[model samples]
Target: MSTPNPNPENRQINIIDPAFTLNPQPVYDEVLTRYRVAKTIGLNSPVISRYEDVIWALRHPEIFSSEMDMHVGLGTERPMIPQQLDPPLQTRYRKILDLQFSRARVMEIEPDVRRHANELIDQFVDAGECEFDRDFAIPLPCRAFLRMMGLPQEDLELFLELKNGIIRPPIANPYDIAAAKEYRAKTGKRIYAYFEALIDDREKSPRDDMMTYFTKVELDGKKLTRNEILDICFLFLLGGLDTVTATLGCSVFYLAENPEHRRRLAEDPSLVPAAVEELLRWQTPVTIVPRILKQDWELDGVQMKAGSMVSLLIGAANVDEQEFGAGEGKCVHFERERNRHIAFGAGPHRCLGSHLARMELRVGLEEWHRRIPSYSIKAGETPRVSPGIREVMYLPLVWEKGGAA
Candidate 1:
């Protein structure tokens, strides 16, 4: 367990670009090859890159605080619902929100999810060509989330805009950051207002939806505060909307490029579930999750001072050769068993929406395989990768008539 190198001079620069222009492979290789865990590039934030160390950091939340305000200099600190809070209180919040995403509950919503996917795909399946991101990936999750949250379906475009502004702030220009902040604030206000109305409505007329559940659930023997409910709703919207969109985009891109893998699942729909996990491991839509050091602690021999920010590179960790079988960890092999990936993260703060997200991916892949059985990227057109708070974006593909189905 060698200590992570901390000297700024020794640290590799731009390994984790704020702009996310480069593929993380080189950075991951450097970190894993040399230190297993090393100081981050550019910002010099401490980075835990290996699968095991990253899991350790996630599990020991007391030492690695998820509180957003501690690292205000990096970006705006939106209260991240249960994500930013630690246990006792975090547990309470999780309990209140977990029911909505429970396996049984998500199963109940599967028909609606499948219907939404079909409806979105129906629009472009016959077009012979379509931008997968805008046509299918973007709309599917946004619409599904709106339906689940009981939000107006018409607000999908606005939701996508606001979510992008907040998550992928333009770090290259100060002006962009300012504009993103403004957009985030504006959209957040509208979202909060809507959640407040929903909360009130649920209070007056209880229903079976998640909003109603939140409205009635007690935390620490008392009803959740308006701000708390608002924060939770914000988390739900952000979590539900962003991750699956990127993932669906990646899955579509992968299948388009790998015709054999696509055909395998198309011919046998039962493989969709296993294929979803492998795609998540290979694509890792959510690349990194940042946590602030709660107290002075020693990790892999390096001494980390309290309050220093450390990023758990979930993407890098998932691809660790030590954990997953080798020959570069990026390859997708759906039949591989014992495939435990950290795409959903780990420990207490591990994705609250993991079950629902998995369901969405499974169903989305099934519907995609059924509708668009064979598609390919256009010639001379390379996919544009957009890495931000997460990775994978704007995957464009075209198929011959009836090829997708």
Candidate 2:
């Protein structure tokens, strides 16, 4: 996946760069091949790259704390529940959350996910050309989220506006940090107010939905506080809607360039699950996760301060030859056995929605291949990927009219 870098020591990687988001495997390769702990160019944070080292950091939350004051600008009034906390409080929250997002519960939503995929395809499958991100990548997950949260489908536009306001902030200048923060703070208030109303509505008339469950579910013999429920919903609103969309976009983008791999799935649909996992590892949409050190500790000969931020390069760790193998073309093998990639993180705080995410990715690819099986990137247009999540914000795709071969 990467040409060998003779001078990996001098390699300058900016995780927020379009180049990195477009193709991060080379940077991962270089980091794994040369340095155990590295640093990024633009962000200038210490990076932990090896698979073993990363797993250690993820597992030992006491040494590497997730609790921090980093997300105020992202519209989080408080730490978004569970994700931003460590055990045993985080563990208790997961006990309540796990049931809501279990594999069996997630499977209940599959039919709707499949139906939505086909409906999205129907809109553009006959046109022979479509902007994949706008047409399919964005809405599918948003609709699924609306269903899961028991929100009205017609509010998709407003939801998108709120999400975009917090994420990209809709500022005229991308570098205007002050304006972006101010805009997100305003959006944060809206998110809280909206969810607060939903919590109230659920209290008045409970339904068989996540919001209702949160309203009634007892934790340690008492129902959750309103702030706790609001915090949890806030996490779900941001995480549930964005992650699958980004992963789906990156996966389809991969298949577009690698027609051979795409043909494999089209010819045999059963490979979709494995293909999804492989893409999760290869693409690693949520590129880097940050942790603030709880105490002064040295890792892999790198000295660290107590409050310094450690950027765990799970993206690089996923491709590390130490774990995934070093044989030619084997590190990124789609069908590789014994793959324990941590694209979803590891240990106690592993993604709670992984089951739902897998189901969505699998159904999405299966349906897309079933209908638009032979699409490619539109000529004279390059995919535009965002910096943080590696989302293909502008992915123009084209195929022969009515083509399914």
Candidate 3:
């Protein structure tokens, strides 16, 4: 609740500070430079901010366990499947889950993804201006994944609200424990009920989509329980829908600000793929990932007690000068090479939907620029951006009607 230190050099930062949430890079840069590891305000959890330490902790899940319900007050009885399940049991679910998100599978859907991106663009192209988040970014991934999961597209709005309530609740202060818990508890129950009904339907008459697959897939020679299936659905609903929306919004907002970076990708379409990786590195959406300590551990000489939570600053680590050379002016290089960003994380819990995420970003950027190359942030409008998921809520973009710059 404390005001962010007005002076960047000597100021102490709370990760959940509203100002920090508005724009985190400056604070993260300052913190990582001054103190590689620091503690949160009220939570007091050690936040791992360096590239090497972040990856090291992610790799050693034995010590930094993911099983804990890190969102303490969310009322989750169990961790979401696969990502939260450690090694042995995790390995079992992963074996089947891996095939579902395989490169080949994602590639098979590429054309559909591309088509959907264009379809979205077509809706706002002639207007020459649009609110990028709600119209394009949110729906692009939501509609596509809903089809793949055999869920109704009509429910897109419903899911969007539910997802936001959990991650980006509409409260004066996101770090307000009581408000966040109350919002999450109500939203969580609705989400559970929605998926539970879907599960029941899939059970009676399994269809030809992911929902059916989840119902049929066996683990340890037993069908997944309804709650287990719901957990998987819960993860997919959040992962499948929001991450891409947030990433796409951030990508476009940056590209809008830096016309040269936007022009470079538009001129040479081949660079789109690399641009996706670089953008992801520069504007990592999922910022802090919390891991509970299995036992006493030490990171950068800071001893963490057992059962303590460590927040991994994925956004800060991606821009570490050691890994990626200092970004031009700002800390982003669209052409940076040897970029090993853990934006999706590392170890056994690395994002399963990464390939799909990459494809969506690439296609979304390519199609948007293909239609409107010389775009800029609508003048006089300040976009709303947040830190945790680093999203631009309303990206007002305006461009000339020409195809090329």
Alpha carbon lDDT of each predicted model: 0.76, 0.85, 0.79
Q: TM-score of predicted model 3? A: 0.90
What candidate 2 gets wrong by more than 4 Å, as runs, is 1-12, 328-331
Please say which candidate is ahead in lDDT: 2 or 3: 2
Give the Å shift of residue 338 in candidate 1.
Answer: 0.6
Off by over 4 Å in 1: 1-9, 13-22, 70-78, 168-175, 326-330
Question: Which candidate tops lDDT?
Answer: 2
TM-score of each: 0.90, 0.96, 0.90
lDDT of 2 by residue, 1-405 (tens): 333333323555688877788888888877777766678776676888888989999999998888878777788789989988988889999999999999988888889889988888888887899898889989998888787777888989889888888888888998999999999999999999998999999999999998899999999999999999988988887888778889999999989999999999998998899999999988889888888899997855567789888889888888777777766223445677877889899988899989988998999999999888888999999899998887899999999995653
Clash totals, every prediction: 5, 0, 0
RMSD of 3: 4.2
Global Cα RMSD, each model: 2.9, 2.7, 4.2
For 1-405, candidate 1 gives per-residue lDDT tens digits of 334465534654364454443356666666766775566664577777889889988898888878757323222235667877888779877887787778887788789989999998888888877888778877888887877776678988877766665566544665565675666666666767777788888889987777777777887789888788887777777677878988887777778778899889999999999999998887788888888888887765677789888878887888888888677476778887778899999999888878888888999989887888778887778776665544345566777886666
